[model samples]
Target: MSTKTKVPKQPLSEQLSVGIPDAGMFEDIPKIRRVAGDSAGPRMKGKVVIVTGANSLQGIGRASAHQYAHNGAKAVFICDYSDNHLETHKRELNSLYPDVDIHPRQFDASNEAAVKAVCEEAIQKYGRLDVYFANAGIATGAVFTDIDSAEFMTMMRVNVLSVFLGAKYAAKAMLLTSPSKPHPSGSIIGTASVAGLRSNAGSTPYSASKAAVVSLMQTISYQLAGTGIRANAICPGVIETGMTSLMYEAARARGTEKKIGQLNPLKRGAVADEVARVALFLGSEESSYVNGQAWAVCGGLSAGHPFVPGRLS
Candidate 1:
Protein backbone atom coordinates (compact mmCIF):
# COMPACT_ATOMS: atom_id res chain seq x y z
CA MET A 1 0.00 0.00 0.00
CA SER A 2 1.08 3.56 -0.61
CA THR A 3 2.31 5.41 2.51
CA LYS A 4 0.59 8.71 1.79
CA THR A 5 -0.65 10.79 4.73
CA LYS A 6 -4.38 10.89 5.35
CA VAL A 7 -6.31 13.73 6.87
CA PRO A 8 -8.88 12.47 9.31
CA LYS A 9 -12.27 13.17 7.84
CA GLN A 10 -14.27 15.83 9.64
CA PRO A 11 -17.62 14.71 10.97
CA LEU A 12 -20.27 16.15 8.70
CA SER A 13 -22.06 17.91 11.56
CA GLU A 14 -18.88 19.47 12.94
CA GLN A 15 -17.89 20.57 9.47
CA LEU A 16 -21.29 22.17 9.11
CA SER A 17 -21.08 23.87 12.50
CA VAL A 18 -17.51 25.13 12.10
CA GLY A 19 -18.67 27.03 9.00
CA ILE A 20 -15.24 28.22 7.89
CA PRO A 21 -12.25 26.07 7.11
CA ASP A 22 -9.29 27.65 8.86
CA ALA A 23 -5.71 28.25 7.73
CA GLY A 24 -4.63 25.68 10.32
CA MET A 25 -6.52 22.98 8.39
CA PHE A 26 -4.68 23.55 5.13
CA GLU A 27 -2.07 20.85 5.80
CA ASP A 28 -4.78 18.19 5.91
CA ILE A 29 -6.22 18.54 2.43
CA PRO A 30 -4.14 16.90 -0.30
CA LYS A 31 -5.68 18.75 -3.22
CA ILE A 32 -5.65 22.17 -1.52
CA ARG A 33 -2.02 22.35 -0.49
CA ARG A 34 -1.36 25.93 -1.54
CA VAL A 35 2.27 26.00 -2.66
CA ALA A 36 2.79 29.01 -0.41
CA GLY A 37 1.54 27.11 2.67
CA ASP A 38 -0.89 29.94 3.39
CA SER A 39 -3.74 27.76 2.11
CA ALA A 40 -6.81 26.80 4.09
CA GLY A 41 -9.84 24.52 3.91
CA PRO A 42 -13.62 25.22 4.13
CA ARG A 43 -13.10 28.67 2.75
CA MET A 44 -16.78 28.98 1.97
CA LYS A 45 -18.01 28.84 5.58
CA GLY A 46 -21.64 29.89 5.94
CA LYS A 47 -22.01 31.50 2.53
CA VAL A 48 -25.13 31.00 0.43
CA VAL A 49 -24.22 29.63 -3.00
CA ILE A 50 -25.80 28.52 -6.28
CA VAL A 51 -24.62 25.88 -8.75
CA THR A 52 -26.38 25.45 -12.09
CA GLY A 53 -26.51 22.33 -14.31
CA ALA A 54 -26.25 19.98 -11.37
CA ASN A 55 -28.36 17.30 -13.11
CA SER A 56 -25.78 14.74 -14.05
CA LEU A 57 -24.06 12.24 -11.79
CA GLN A 58 -20.77 12.82 -13.61
CA GLY A 59 -21.01 16.56 -13.98
CA ILE A 60 -18.76 19.22 -12.42
CA GLY A 61 -21.76 21.22 -11.27
CA ARG A 62 -23.05 18.31 -9.18
CA ALA A 63 -19.63 17.73 -7.65
CA SER A 64 -19.24 21.42 -6.89
CA ALA A 65 -22.72 21.66 -5.36
CA HIS A 66 -21.87 18.92 -2.89
CA GLN A 67 -18.47 20.43 -2.17
CA TYR A 68 -20.11 23.68 -1.18
CA ALA A 69 -22.34 21.84 1.27
CA HIS A 70 -19.51 19.65 2.52
CA ASN A 71 -17.48 22.79 3.29
CA GLY A 72 -20.26 24.35 5.38
CA ALA A 73 -22.00 26.66 2.97
CA LYS A 74 -25.05 28.13 4.70
CA ALA A 75 -27.17 27.22 1.70
CA VAL A 76 -26.68 25.50 -1.63
CA PHE A 77 -29.26 25.96 -4.38
CA ILE A 78 -28.77 22.96 -6.65
CA CYS A 79 -30.43 23.40 -10.04
CA ASP A 80 -30.98 21.63 -13.32
CA TYR A 81 -33.80 21.09 -15.83
CA SER A 82 -36.22 18.23 -15.17
CA ASP A 83 -34.01 15.53 -13.70
CA ASN A 84 -35.95 12.61 -12.22
CA HIS A 85 -33.38 12.04 -9.51
CA LEU A 86 -33.24 15.62 -8.26
CA GLU A 87 -35.42 15.00 -5.21
CA THR A 88 -33.50 11.88 -4.23
CA HIS A 89 -30.26 13.77 -4.63
CA LYS A 90 -31.63 16.56 -2.48
CA ARG A 91 -32.48 14.12 0.29
CA GLU A 92 -29.01 12.56 0.09
CA LEU A 93 -27.36 15.94 0.40
CA ASN A 94 -29.57 16.89 3.34
CA SER A 95 -28.75 13.68 5.15
CA LEU A 96 -25.03 14.19 4.52
CA TYR A 97 -25.00 17.84 5.64
CA PRO A 98 -28.04 18.44 7.80
CA ASP A 99 -26.81 21.86 8.87
CA VAL A 100 -26.99 23.15 5.32
CA ASP A 101 -30.20 24.38 3.76
CA ILE A 102 -30.34 22.59 0.39
CA HIS A 103 -32.85 23.55 -2.23
CA PRO A 104 -33.32 21.80 -5.57
CA ARG A 105 -34.96 23.56 -8.46
CA GLN A 106 -35.74 22.68 -12.06
CA PHE A 107 -35.85 25.31 -14.78
CA ASP A 108 -34.58 26.18 -18.22
CA ALA A 109 -31.25 27.80 -17.43
CA SER A 110 -31.06 29.69 -20.71
CA ASN A 111 -34.37 31.38 -20.00
CA GLU A 112 -33.84 34.88 -18.64
CA ALA A 113 -36.90 34.97 -16.38
CA ALA A 114 -36.02 31.62 -14.84
CA VAL A 115 -32.44 32.62 -14.15
CA LYS A 116 -33.56 35.82 -12.45
CA ALA A 117 -36.14 33.95 -10.40
CA VAL A 118 -33.64 31.49 -8.94
CA CYS A 119 -31.31 34.25 -7.83
CA GLU A 120 -34.22 36.08 -6.33
CA GLU A 121 -35.30 33.01 -4.41
CA ALA A 122 -31.84 32.47 -2.97
CA ILE A 123 -31.56 36.07 -1.84
CA GLN A 124 -34.99 35.91 -0.20
CA LYS A 125 -34.09 32.70 1.64
CA TYR A 126 -30.51 33.32 2.69
CA GLY A 127 -30.53 37.13 2.61
CA ARG A 128 -27.65 37.16 0.06
CA LEU A 129 -25.95 35.15 -2.63
CA ASP A 130 -22.22 34.67 -2.18
CA VAL A 131 -21.32 32.35 -5.04
CA TYR A 132 -23.07 31.65 -8.34
CA PHE A 133 -21.55 28.83 -10.38
CA ALA A 134 -22.97 29.05 -13.90
CA ASN A 135 -21.90 25.65 -15.09
CA ALA A 136 -24.80 24.59 -17.32
CA GLY A 137 -23.60 24.01 -20.89
CA ILE A 138 -24.25 21.97 -24.02
CA ALA A 139 -21.85 20.44 -26.51
CA THR A 140 -22.71 21.02 -30.17
CA GLY A 141 -21.27 17.87 -31.66
CA ALA A 142 -21.15 19.04 -35.27
CA VAL A 143 -18.83 20.74 -37.75
CA PHE A 144 -19.68 24.10 -39.31
CA THR A 145 -21.15 22.63 -42.46
CA ASP A 146 -23.35 20.26 -40.51
CA ILE A 147 -24.57 22.88 -38.02
CA ASP A 148 -27.40 25.31 -38.72
CA SER A 149 -28.05 28.79 -37.36
CA ALA A 150 -30.67 27.45 -34.95
CA GLU A 151 -28.27 24.85 -33.55
CA PHE A 152 -25.53 27.44 -33.25
CA MET A 153 -27.84 29.79 -31.41
CA THR A 154 -29.00 27.05 -29.06
CA MET A 155 -25.44 26.28 -28.07
CA MET A 156 -24.73 29.94 -27.50
CA ARG A 157 -27.86 30.39 -25.43
CA VAL A 158 -27.06 27.42 -23.25
CA ASN A 159 -23.33 28.05 -22.90
CA VAL A 160 -22.65 31.76 -23.27
CA LEU A 161 -26.03 33.27 -22.47
CA SER A 162 -26.41 31.35 -19.23
CA VAL A 163 -23.18 32.77 -17.87
CA PHE A 164 -24.22 36.27 -18.83
CA LEU A 165 -27.51 35.92 -17.00
CA GLY A 166 -25.92 34.38 -13.91
CA ALA A 167 -23.35 37.17 -13.75
CA LYS A 168 -26.00 39.82 -14.05
CA TYR A 169 -28.37 38.57 -11.35
CA ALA A 170 -25.75 37.13 -9.04
CA ALA A 171 -23.84 40.41 -9.05
CA LYS A 172 -27.00 42.27 -8.23
CA ALA A 173 -27.66 39.99 -5.28
CA MET A 174 -24.06 40.13 -4.03
CA LEU A 175 -24.03 43.91 -4.21
CA LEU A 176 -27.12 44.00 -2.05
CA THR A 177 -25.37 41.99 0.66
CA SER A 178 -24.45 44.12 3.68
CA PRO A 179 -20.90 45.43 3.37
CA SER A 180 -20.39 44.32 6.95
CA LYS A 181 -20.81 40.69 5.91
CA PRO A 182 -17.66 38.60 5.59
CA HIS A 183 -17.93 38.35 1.79
CA PRO A 184 -20.21 41.17 0.85
CA SER A 185 -18.91 41.13 -2.67
CA GLY A 186 -19.04 37.54 -3.79
CA SER A 187 -17.71 35.19 -6.49
CA ILE A 188 -19.25 34.05 -9.78
CA ILE A 189 -17.71 31.01 -11.49
CA GLY A 190 -18.45 29.72 -15.00
CA THR A 191 -17.50 26.38 -16.49
CA ALA A 192 -15.63 27.13 -19.69
CA SER A 193 -13.64 24.62 -21.75
CA VAL A 194 -9.98 24.48 -22.76
CA ALA A 195 -11.28 24.39 -26.31
CA GLY A 196 -12.10 28.04 -25.65
CA LEU A 197 -8.47 28.73 -24.72
CA ARG A 198 -7.02 27.70 -28.13
CA SER A 199 -7.73 25.99 -31.43
CA ASN A 200 -7.80 22.49 -30.08
CA ALA A 201 -10.13 19.62 -31.11
CA GLY A 202 -13.88 20.11 -30.53
CA SER A 203 -17.15 20.94 -32.30
CA THR A 204 -17.17 24.19 -34.23
CA PRO A 205 -20.23 25.73 -32.62
CA TYR A 206 -19.27 24.43 -29.19
CA SER A 207 -15.83 25.97 -29.56
CA ALA A 208 -17.22 29.34 -30.56
CA SER A 209 -19.71 29.34 -27.70
CA LYS A 210 -17.08 28.48 -25.06
CA ALA A 211 -14.77 31.12 -26.48
CA ALA A 212 -17.58 33.59 -25.98
CA VAL A 213 -17.99 32.40 -22.36
CA VAL A 214 -14.32 33.04 -21.66
CA SER A 215 -14.45 36.48 -23.22
CA LEU A 216 -17.66 37.19 -21.34
CA MET A 217 -15.98 36.46 -17.99
CA GLN A 218 -12.93 38.61 -18.81
CA THR A 219 -15.13 41.49 -19.87
CA ILE A 220 -17.49 41.21 -16.90
CA SER A 221 -14.67 41.05 -14.39
CA TYR A 222 -13.56 44.45 -15.67
CA GLN A 223 -17.12 45.79 -15.50
CA LEU A 224 -17.35 44.84 -11.81
CA ALA A 225 -14.07 46.52 -10.89
CA GLY A 226 -13.84 47.72 -7.23
CA THR A 227 -17.28 46.31 -6.48
CA GLY A 228 -15.84 43.46 -4.38
CA ILE A 229 -17.66 41.02 -6.67
CA ARG A 230 -15.45 38.92 -8.99
CA ALA A 231 -16.09 36.77 -12.07
CA ASN A 232 -13.87 33.96 -13.40
CA ALA A 233 -13.96 30.91 -15.70
CA ILE A 234 -12.37 27.47 -15.66
CA CYS A 235 -11.12 25.92 -18.92
CA PRO A 236 -11.12 22.19 -18.33
CA GLY A 237 -9.35 19.68 -20.55
CA VAL A 238 -10.32 16.02 -21.19
CA ILE A 239 -12.48 14.77 -18.36
CA GLU A 240 -14.88 11.86 -18.14
CA THR A 241 -18.21 13.55 -17.67
CA GLY A 242 -21.66 13.15 -19.20
CA MET A 243 -20.55 15.58 -21.90
CA THR A 244 -17.64 13.32 -22.93
CA SER A 245 -19.10 9.95 -22.02
CA LEU A 246 -19.32 8.98 -25.67
CA MET A 247 -15.57 9.23 -26.04
CA TYR A 248 -15.03 7.09 -22.98
CA GLU A 249 -17.60 4.55 -24.19
CA ALA A 250 -15.95 4.21 -27.58
CA ALA A 251 -12.47 3.87 -26.07
CA ARG A 252 -13.65 1.30 -23.58
CA ALA A 253 -15.35 -0.72 -26.29
CA ARG A 254 -11.95 -1.17 -27.91
CA GLY A 255 -10.19 -1.52 -24.57
CA THR A 256 -8.39 1.75 -25.20
CA GLU A 257 -9.88 3.72 -22.29
CA LYS A 258 -6.49 4.05 -20.66
CA LYS A 259 -5.33 6.12 -23.62
CA ILE A 260 -8.14 8.68 -23.39
CA GLY A 261 -5.92 11.51 -22.17
CA GLN A 262 -2.59 10.30 -23.51
CA LEU A 263 -1.96 13.61 -25.24
CA ASN A 264 -1.50 15.33 -21.85
CA PRO A 265 1.63 14.88 -19.78
CA LEU A 266 -0.31 13.05 -17.08
CA LYS A 267 -1.25 10.43 -19.69
CA ARG A 268 -4.71 9.96 -18.19
CA GLY A 269 -8.07 11.70 -18.11
CA ALA A 270 -9.70 13.39 -15.10
CA VAL A 271 -12.99 12.92 -13.30
CA ALA A 272 -15.74 15.38 -12.31
CA ASP A 273 -14.13 15.81 -8.86
CA GLU A 274 -10.97 17.27 -10.39
CA VAL A 275 -12.70 20.18 -12.06
CA ALA A 276 -15.06 20.56 -9.09
CA ARG A 277 -12.05 21.12 -6.84
CA VAL A 278 -11.15 24.17 -8.93
CA ALA A 279 -14.74 25.39 -8.67
CA LEU A 280 -14.56 25.04 -4.89
CA PHE A 281 -11.43 27.21 -4.80
CA LEU A 282 -12.88 29.85 -7.10
CA GLY A 283 -16.06 29.92 -5.02
CA SER A 284 -14.14 30.29 -1.72
CA GLU A 285 -12.41 33.24 -0.05
CA GLU A 286 -9.02 31.81 -0.94
CA SER A 287 -9.54 33.24 -4.43
CA SER A 288 -10.26 36.74 -3.16
CA TYR A 289 -7.41 38.21 -5.25
CA VAL A 290 -8.25 36.05 -8.27
CA ASN A 291 -10.70 37.69 -10.61
CA GLY A 292 -11.51 38.03 -14.30
CA GLN A 293 -9.06 35.22 -15.06
CA ALA A 294 -9.68 32.18 -17.25
CA TRP A 295 -7.85 29.29 -15.59
CA ALA A 296 -6.86 26.10 -17.50
CA VAL A 297 -7.36 22.92 -15.42
CA CYS A 298 -6.28 20.42 -18.06
CA GLY A 299 -3.31 18.64 -16.52
CA GLY A 300 -0.80 20.62 -18.68
CA LEU A 301 -2.58 19.74 -21.89
CA SER A 302 -2.92 23.45 -22.61
CA ALA A 303 0.87 23.85 -22.53
CA GLY A 304 1.17 21.86 -25.76
CA HIS A 305 0.34 18.40 -27.10
CA PRO A 306 2.82 16.02 -25.50
CA PHE A 307 5.36 14.70 -27.97
CA VAL A 308 7.98 12.05 -27.28
CA PRO A 309 11.39 13.71 -27.00
CA GLY A 310 13.45 10.90 -28.55
CA ARG A 311 12.56 8.47 -25.77
CA LEU A 312 10.37 5.84 -27.41
CA SER A 313 8.48 3.53 -25.10
Candidate 2:
Protein backbone atom coordinates (compact mmCIF):
# COMPACT_ATOMS: atom_id res chain seq x y z
CA MET A 1 0.00 0.00 0.00
CA SER A 2 1.37 3.37 -1.01
CA THR A 3 0.43 6.44 1.07
CA LYS A 4 0.51 10.02 -0.33
CA THR A 5 1.33 13.06 1.88
CA LYS A 6 -1.57 15.44 2.45
CA VAL A 7 -1.32 18.95 0.88
CA PRO A 8 -2.82 21.92 2.68
CA LYS A 9 -5.00 24.26 0.70
CA GLN A 10 -4.19 28.02 0.51
CA PRO A 11 -6.53 30.61 2.04
CA LEU A 12 -9.34 32.04 -0.09
CA SER A 13 -7.71 35.45 -0.13
CA GLU A 14 -4.46 34.02 -1.47
CA GLN A 15 -6.14 31.83 -4.10
CA LEU A 16 -7.38 33.24 -7.38
CA SER A 17 -11.17 33.39 -7.25
CA VAL A 18 -13.78 34.93 -9.49
CA GLY A 19 -16.15 37.59 -8.12
CA ILE A 20 -15.39 36.83 -4.45
CA PRO A 21 -15.34 40.40 -3.14
CA ASP A 22 -11.64 41.16 -3.77
CA ALA A 23 -9.32 40.46 -0.85
CA GLY A 24 -7.54 43.82 -0.71
CA MET A 25 -9.66 46.74 0.44
CA PHE A 26 -9.17 50.41 -0.40
CA GLU A 27 -9.51 53.24 2.09
CA ASP A 28 -8.96 57.00 2.01
CA ILE A 29 -5.69 58.05 3.55
CA PRO A 30 -5.55 60.98 5.96
CA LYS A 31 -3.86 64.18 4.93
CA ILE A 32 -0.55 65.11 6.59
CA ARG A 33 -1.86 68.38 7.98
CA ARG A 34 -5.21 70.21 7.87
CA VAL A 35 -5.57 73.95 7.59
CA ALA A 36 -9.33 74.03 8.07
CA GLY A 37 -12.03 71.75 9.44
CA ASP A 38 -12.36 68.68 7.23
CA SER A 39 -10.26 70.45 4.59
CA ALA A 40 -6.75 69.56 3.45
CA GLY A 41 -5.44 72.68 1.77
CA PRO A 42 -2.98 75.55 2.20
CA ARG A 43 -1.29 74.87 5.50
CA MET A 44 0.62 78.14 5.25
CA LYS A 45 -2.28 80.42 4.45
CA GLY A 46 -1.50 84.15 4.47
CA LYS A 47 2.16 83.75 5.36
CA VAL A 48 4.88 85.82 3.70
CA VAL A 49 7.85 83.78 2.37
CA ILE A 50 11.15 84.72 0.78
CA VAL A 51 13.25 82.30 -1.30
CA THR A 52 16.71 83.12 -2.64
CA GLY A 53 18.28 81.76 -5.87
CA ALA A 54 14.84 81.23 -7.35
CA ASN A 55 15.76 82.22 -10.89
CA SER A 56 16.67 78.77 -12.19
CA LEU A 57 13.74 76.50 -12.97
CA GLN A 58 15.78 73.39 -12.07
CA GLY A 59 16.91 74.61 -8.67
CA ILE A 60 15.86 74.03 -5.07
CA GLY A 61 15.04 77.70 -4.59
CA ARG A 62 12.49 77.76 -7.41
CA ALA A 63 10.95 74.50 -6.20
CA SER A 64 10.58 75.88 -2.65
CA ALA A 65 9.01 79.07 -3.99
CA HIS A 66 6.34 77.14 -5.86
CA GLN A 67 5.69 74.87 -2.87
CA TYR A 68 5.21 77.84 -0.55
CA ALA A 69 2.89 79.58 -2.99
CA HIS A 70 0.86 76.43 -3.49
CA ASN A 71 0.54 75.97 0.27
CA GLY A 72 -1.34 79.30 0.64
CA ALA A 73 1.41 81.76 1.29
CA LYS A 74 0.07 85.27 0.83
CA ALA A 75 3.24 86.57 -0.83
CA VAL A 76 6.57 85.10 -2.01
CA PHE A 77 9.71 87.15 -2.61
CA ILE A 78 11.89 85.50 -5.27
CA CYS A 79 15.47 86.76 -5.28
CA ASP A 80 18.32 85.93 -7.66
CA TYR A 81 21.22 87.60 -9.38
CA SER A 82 19.77 86.85 -12.82
CA ASP A 83 17.33 89.66 -13.50
CA ASN A 84 16.01 88.31 -16.81
CA HIS A 85 15.59 84.79 -15.46
CA LEU A 86 14.01 86.08 -12.27
CA GLU A 87 11.51 88.08 -14.28
CA THR A 88 10.78 85.02 -16.40
CA HIS A 89 10.23 82.92 -13.27
CA LYS A 90 7.95 85.60 -11.91
CA ARG A 91 5.90 85.56 -15.11
CA GLU A 92 5.72 81.77 -15.08
CA LEU A 93 4.63 81.67 -11.44
CA ASN A 94 2.05 84.40 -12.00
CA SER A 95 0.64 82.54 -14.99
CA LEU A 96 0.41 79.31 -13.06
CA TYR A 97 -1.13 80.87 -9.92
CA PRO A 98 -3.12 83.85 -11.12
CA ASP A 99 -4.03 85.12 -7.65
CA VAL A 100 -0.69 84.44 -5.95
CA ASP A 101 1.62 87.36 -5.17
CA ILE A 102 5.26 86.88 -6.26
CA HIS A 103 7.85 89.62 -5.95
CA PRO A 104 10.97 89.17 -8.11
CA ARG A 105 14.23 90.91 -7.22
CA GLN A 106 17.76 90.72 -8.65
CA PHE A 107 20.58 90.93 -6.14
CA ASP A 108 23.84 89.11 -5.51
CA ALA A 109 23.30 87.18 -2.30
CA SER A 110 27.02 87.07 -1.54
CA ASN A 111 27.21 90.85 -1.46
CA GLU A 112 26.42 92.10 2.04
CA ALA A 113 25.10 95.45 0.85
CA ALA A 114 23.04 93.81 -1.86
CA VAL A 115 21.47 91.39 0.60
CA LYS A 116 20.66 94.17 3.06
CA ALA A 117 19.12 96.31 0.31
CA VAL A 118 17.05 93.39 -0.94
CA CYS A 119 15.79 92.70 2.57
CA GLU A 120 14.78 96.35 2.97
CA GLU A 121 13.00 96.31 -0.36
CA ALA A 122 11.15 93.11 0.50
CA ILE A 123 10.12 94.45 3.91
CA GLN A 124 8.92 97.66 2.28
CA LYS A 125 6.81 95.69 -0.15
CA TYR A 126 5.55 92.85 2.06
CA GLY A 127 5.47 94.66 5.46
CA ARG A 128 6.96 91.54 7.08
CA LEU A 129 8.69 88.27 6.22
CA ASP A 130 7.40 85.25 8.08
CA VAL A 131 9.80 82.75 6.51
CA TYR A 132 13.15 83.13 4.77
CA PHE A 133 14.73 80.33 2.68
CA ALA A 134 18.35 80.98 1.82
CA ASN A 135 18.83 78.46 -0.93
CA ALA A 136 21.55 80.04 -3.07
CA GLY A 137 24.86 78.21 -3.55
CA ILE A 138 27.62 77.33 -6.04
CA ALA A 139 29.85 74.26 -6.31
CA THR A 140 33.04 73.37 -8.14
CA GLY A 141 33.90 69.84 -9.24
CA ALA A 142 37.66 70.09 -8.94
CA VAL A 143 39.61 68.09 -6.41
CA PHE A 144 41.33 69.91 -3.59
CA THR A 145 44.79 69.29 -5.02
CA ASP A 146 43.78 70.54 -8.47
CA ILE A 147 41.71 73.54 -7.35
CA ASP A 148 43.26 76.97 -7.63
CA SER A 149 43.31 79.41 -4.73
CA ALA A 150 40.95 81.77 -6.53
CA GLU A 151 38.48 78.95 -7.21
CA PHE A 152 38.46 77.96 -3.56
CA MET A 153 37.85 81.54 -2.49
CA THR A 154 35.12 82.03 -5.07
CA MET A 155 33.34 78.87 -3.96
CA MET A 156 33.54 79.91 -0.33
CA ARG A 157 32.30 83.42 -1.09
CA VAL A 158 29.38 82.23 -3.16
CA ASN A 159 28.32 79.15 -1.20
CA VAL A 160 29.21 80.12 2.36
CA LEU A 161 29.21 83.93 2.33
CA SER A 162 25.92 84.09 0.44
CA VAL A 163 24.16 82.03 3.11
CA PHE A 164 25.70 84.13 5.84
CA LEU A 165 24.56 87.37 4.28
CA GLY A 166 21.08 86.06 3.61
CA ALA A 167 20.61 84.80 7.18
CA LYS A 168 22.13 87.92 8.71
CA TYR A 169 19.80 90.27 6.88
CA ALA A 170 16.75 88.06 7.22
CA ALA A 171 17.27 87.66 10.96
CA LYS A 172 17.71 91.39 11.39
CA ALA A 173 14.54 92.08 9.43
CA MET A 174 12.57 89.51 11.40
CA LEU A 175 13.73 91.02 14.69
CA LEU A 176 12.40 94.44 13.73
CA THR A 177 9.02 93.28 12.44
CA SER A 178 6.47 92.28 15.04
CA PRO A 179 4.63 89.06 14.36
CA SER A 180 0.85 88.75 14.22
CA LYS A 181 -1.06 88.66 17.53
CA PRO A 182 -1.40 84.92 17.64
CA HIS A 183 1.75 83.79 15.81
CA PRO A 184 4.63 85.65 17.39
CA SER A 185 7.49 84.06 15.50
CA GLY A 186 9.38 83.66 12.21
CA SER A 187 11.55 81.01 10.49
CA ILE A 188 14.82 81.10 8.54
CA ILE A 189 16.19 78.18 6.50
CA GLY A 190 19.54 77.66 4.79
CA THR A 191 20.61 75.10 2.17
CA ALA A 192 23.51 72.98 3.23
CA SER A 193 24.48 69.57 1.74
CA VAL A 194 25.56 66.02 2.58
CA ALA A 195 29.00 67.23 1.58
CA GLY A 196 28.88 69.34 4.72
CA LEU A 197 28.33 66.38 6.99
CA ARG A 198 31.01 64.21 5.41
CA SER A 199 33.87 64.90 3.07
CA ASN A 200 33.30 64.43 -0.65
CA ALA A 201 36.12 62.89 -2.66
CA GLY A 202 36.66 65.71 -5.16
CA SER A 203 34.65 68.63 -3.80
CA THR A 204 36.63 69.80 -0.81
CA PRO A 205 35.82 73.48 -1.23
CA TYR A 206 32.15 72.77 -1.76
CA SER A 207 32.02 70.56 1.31
CA ALA A 208 33.84 73.12 3.44
CA SER A 209 31.54 75.91 2.34
CA LYS A 210 28.43 73.91 3.14
CA ALA A 211 29.81 72.86 6.52
CA ALA A 212 30.22 76.55 7.27
CA VAL A 213 26.57 77.08 6.36
CA VAL A 214 25.55 74.40 8.87
CA SER A 215 27.57 76.13 11.55
CA LEU A 216 26.07 79.47 10.65
CA MET A 217 22.53 78.14 10.99
CA GLN A 218 23.31 76.63 14.40
CA THR A 219 24.92 79.85 15.61
CA ILE A 220 22.04 81.97 14.37
CA SER A 221 19.54 79.65 15.98
CA TYR A 222 21.27 80.00 19.34
CA GLN A 223 21.60 83.77 19.04
CA LEU A 224 17.89 84.12 18.21
CA ALA A 225 16.71 81.52 20.74
CA GLY A 226 14.67 84.00 22.76
CA THR A 227 13.74 86.28 19.86
CA GLY A 228 11.19 83.93 18.24
CA ILE A 229 13.27 83.70 15.05
CA ARG A 230 14.05 80.03 14.33
CA ALA A 231 16.94 79.01 12.08
CA ASN A 232 17.70 75.67 10.42
CA ALA A 233 19.56 74.09 7.49
CA ILE A 234 18.50 71.67 4.77
CA CYS A 235 21.26 69.31 3.69
CA PRO A 236 20.45 67.63 0.39
CA GLY A 237 22.32 64.71 -1.16
CA VAL A 238 22.52 63.58 -4.80
CA ILE A 239 19.48 65.63 -5.80
CA GLU A 240 18.62 65.62 -9.51
CA THR A 241 18.86 69.34 -10.24
CA GLY A 242 20.95 71.47 -12.56
CA MET A 243 23.82 71.11 -10.12
CA THR A 244 23.50 67.35 -9.91
CA SER A 245 22.96 67.15 -13.65
CA LEU A 246 26.41 68.55 -14.13
CA MET A 247 27.82 66.03 -11.67
CA TYR A 248 25.94 63.16 -13.32
CA GLU A 249 27.14 64.15 -16.76
CA ALA A 250 30.66 64.34 -15.46
CA ALA A 251 30.29 60.92 -13.87
CA ARG A 252 28.95 59.51 -17.13
CA ALA A 253 31.87 61.01 -19.01
CA ARG A 254 34.13 59.22 -16.57
CA GLY A 255 32.10 56.01 -17.05
CA THR A 256 31.01 55.91 -13.42
CA GLU A 257 27.24 56.30 -13.45
CA LYS A 258 26.68 52.88 -11.89
CA LYS A 259 29.40 53.49 -9.33
CA ILE A 260 28.05 56.88 -8.37
CA GLY A 261 24.44 55.74 -7.95
CA GLN A 262 25.67 52.74 -5.96
CA LEU A 263 27.28 55.16 -3.52
CA ASN A 264 23.83 55.91 -2.05
CA PRO A 265 21.78 53.24 -0.35
CA LEU A 266 18.61 54.38 -2.13
CA LYS A 267 20.28 53.38 -5.43
CA ARG A 268 18.79 56.53 -6.99
CA GLY A 269 19.00 60.29 -6.72
CA ALA A 270 16.29 62.66 -5.49
CA VAL A 271 14.46 65.37 -7.38
CA ALA A 272 14.64 69.06 -6.52
CA ASP A 273 11.03 68.83 -5.35
CA GLU A 274 12.02 66.32 -2.67
CA VAL A 275 14.42 68.77 -1.09
CA ALA A 276 12.00 71.66 -1.59
CA ARG A 277 9.32 69.87 0.39
CA VAL A 278 11.59 69.77 3.43
CA ALA A 279 12.38 73.46 3.04
CA LEU A 280 8.69 74.22 2.90
CA PHE A 281 8.10 72.22 6.06
CA LEU A 282 10.83 74.10 7.90
CA GLY A 283 9.59 77.42 6.55
CA SER A 284 5.97 76.80 7.51
CA GLU A 285 4.27 76.92 10.88
CA GLU A 286 4.14 73.12 10.83
CA SER A 287 7.70 73.16 12.14
CA SER A 288 7.26 75.93 14.69
CA TYR A 289 9.10 73.98 17.38
CA VAL A 290 11.90 72.66 15.14
CA ASN A 291 14.93 74.90 15.32
CA GLY A 292 18.72 74.74 14.80
CA GLN A 293 18.48 71.35 13.13
CA ALA A 294 20.30 70.31 9.95
CA TRP A 295 17.62 68.28 8.28
CA ALA A 296 19.07 65.83 5.75
CA VAL A 297 16.98 65.44 2.63
CA CYS A 298 19.36 62.95 1.03
CA GLY A 299 17.12 59.88 0.79
CA GLY A 300 19.13 57.92 3.38
CA LEU A 301 22.34 58.41 1.41
CA SER A 302 23.96 60.29 4.26
CA ALA A 303 22.94 57.65 6.77
CA GLY A 304 24.50 54.87 4.74
CA HIS A 305 28.10 53.74 4.45
CA PRO A 306 30.45 56.31 5.93
CA PHE A 307 33.41 54.98 4.00
CA VAL A 308 33.69 52.91 0.84
CA PRO A 309 37.07 51.71 -0.36
CA GLY A 310 37.40 51.68 -4.09
CA ARG A 311 38.90 48.17 -4.40
CA LEU A 312 38.09 46.53 -1.09
CA SER A 313 35.11 44.55 0.25
TM values, all candidates:
0.84, 0.80
Give per-candidate clash totals.
1, 0
Local error of candidate 2 at residue 127 (angstroms): 1.7
Tens digit per residue, CA lDDT, model 1, 135-220: 99989667799888999898999999999999989988886744335334788998888899877557888888888889988988
Q: Single out the weakest 10-residue window by summed lDDT for candidate 1.
A: 8-17
- Which pairs of residues collide in candidate 1? 19-45
- TM-score result, candidate 2: 0.80
All models: lDDT? 0.83, 0.77
Which candidate's TM-score is highest? 1
Find the 10 residues in a row with the least total lDDT in model 2: 10-19
